[model samples]
Target chain A: MTNEEIRDFIQTAIAENRVMLFMKGTPEQPACGFSMRTSAALNALGVQYAALDILPDPRIRQELSAISNWPTIPQLFVDGELVGGCDIVTEMYESGELAQRVGVEQPQHEPEPPTAEAPQSAPLGVENRLS
Target chain B: MPTATELKERIESALPGSEANVEDLTGGGDHFRAEIVSDRFAGLSRIEQHRLVYDVFGTEIGGPIHALSLKTTTPEGQR
Candidate 1:
């Protein structure tokens, strides 16, 4: 697809999904540390989200940044709004705002600090239909 | 390769009355973490506040600057 088409595709994906993530790789096998931690936050919250891997096409990243005006990857969009990248997402998750925004109860158990490694528990029904 | 000092200077100069503490996270000069406090950030969402800092770098963000982890707060909100 051309750059214009890719941008449209990204915009549509964001509009269609209640919670959308544009990341470097799939949630199960993230290619970047930041992407891993961002997905982990959504996973830990048990929020079902649709994720798109931007690694497959450079244009996807280019157009995604254009559409979101966010320079980084692992961008989380809630209800068609940019929630932010890993740092903001992680901060919100730790503060319970992420769960609140996604309409989920913040898990009572303390979550281990986000590391490069994927969380041990499997993500709850993460949909990768955007690929 | 931009140094931590350069990043700090850029941010401080770009946003008047801002205090920025920048650290090279990996000692690689590319990845950094910056904590910024400025009245300019007042009433802005986290996304908007980060974008203000990001606009200072433009295309350089994903290019020469690989990553810039940010923590921003208004002067009154600083903890």
Candidate 2:
């Protein structure tokens, strides 16, 4: 597909979906470390969302980079809007804003896994059905 | 792929009367940041103004250039 076409498709998907994440891999199988981390953060927030893999089509990744002006993959879109990349998501998670944005009741805070108990959850906001 | 100069030119040429300071933030040949000023942004929402800058790059945004961190303001807003 043309770059503009891809960009439009992605933008529309986001606009129509309430919560979405465009990542390198699926929530069940994150292809990149960044995506993995974001998955973890989303899980911590306890929200359902969709993760679109940009790996199959290099163009999707390229088009997304152009549309968001963000270099990295694993972008988070909340309520059909671009939230930042992993870093931004992590920051928002730390601030508990990520949970708030997605309409999930805040789970009690827990330290990141392999350190302290990270509450009861898996990584990723992979409620792909929602988006 | 667009060279830094070409991207700069596209941004400046497309944005008439916008005084922008565009730079290659990464020096890796893709990422950029622009501090753009214009009177057109007086009442526009932040998202609208950002979208205006995004419009400049069009489809070339993600391919050759990777990032664009923007700070936008009107001549009066800058004060």
Candidate 3:
């Protein structure tokens, strides 16, 4: 597809999905730490969202940035507007604002806040299991 | 591979009157975490506030500067 077509595709996706995520990988298996955290936040909130993996094509990332004016991947869009990248999403998730925006109940159990450390711990836990 | 200090200087210089604390999260000089406080962010949404900082970097953000995690706030106590 031409660059123009790619941009059109992205714009349409944003307009169609109430909550859209343009990330490095799929929601089930995020390739980057930031992408993982962003997806986890949406998952924790239990909101339905459509995710597009930008890693498949460099142009996808380029076109996305062109449309959103956001430089990074793992950008979340709510109601066709840019919500933000990982930091903003995680902050909002913890503060209950994300839930309000999505119109869902923030989980009552208050799951552990997603942190950069959470991803690092997985490898350490794996090493410990091998020992 | 911009150092944390460089990132700090750039952000501070660009925003003027903004306080930016930057740390090289990986120590590799590519990934960084920055917390910024500025009057310039007073009336902006979180997204717009971040964009102000991001605009300073232009294309360097995802280029030489791999990732820049940010937390922006207004000096007036708004987040």
TM-score of each: 0.91, 0.55, 0.90
Check candidate 1 and list the clashing pairs: none
TM-score of 3: 0.90
* Candidate 3 residue-wise lDDT, A1-131, digit = tens: 78888887888888988988888766667899999899888877777888788886788888899889999988999999999999999999999999999898988868588533223112100011100
| Model 3 clashing-pair count | 0
Task: Kindly list the per-residue Cα lDDT of model 1 for residues B1-79, writing each as its tens digit.
Answer: 8999999999999998999999999998999999999999888889999999999999999999999999999889842
Candidate 1: list runs displaced more than 4 Å: A114-131
Model 1 error, position B6 (Å): 0.5
User: Could you tell me how far off, in angstroms, the CA of residue B27 lies in candidate 3 after the best superposition?
Assistant: 0.9
**Model 2 whole-model lDDT (C-alpha atoms):** 0.68
Misplaced by over 4 Å in model 3 are A115-131
Give the candidates in order of lDDT, highest first. 1, 3, 2
lDDT of 2 by residue, A1-131 (tens): 57777788788768866777888776667776667778777766666666678877788877777777655567777776677776557656766677787877766645443111242454334333222
Model 3, C-alpha of A37: deviation from truth (Å): 0.3
Pick the lDDT winner: 1
The DockQ for candidate 1, computed on C-alphas, is: 0.92
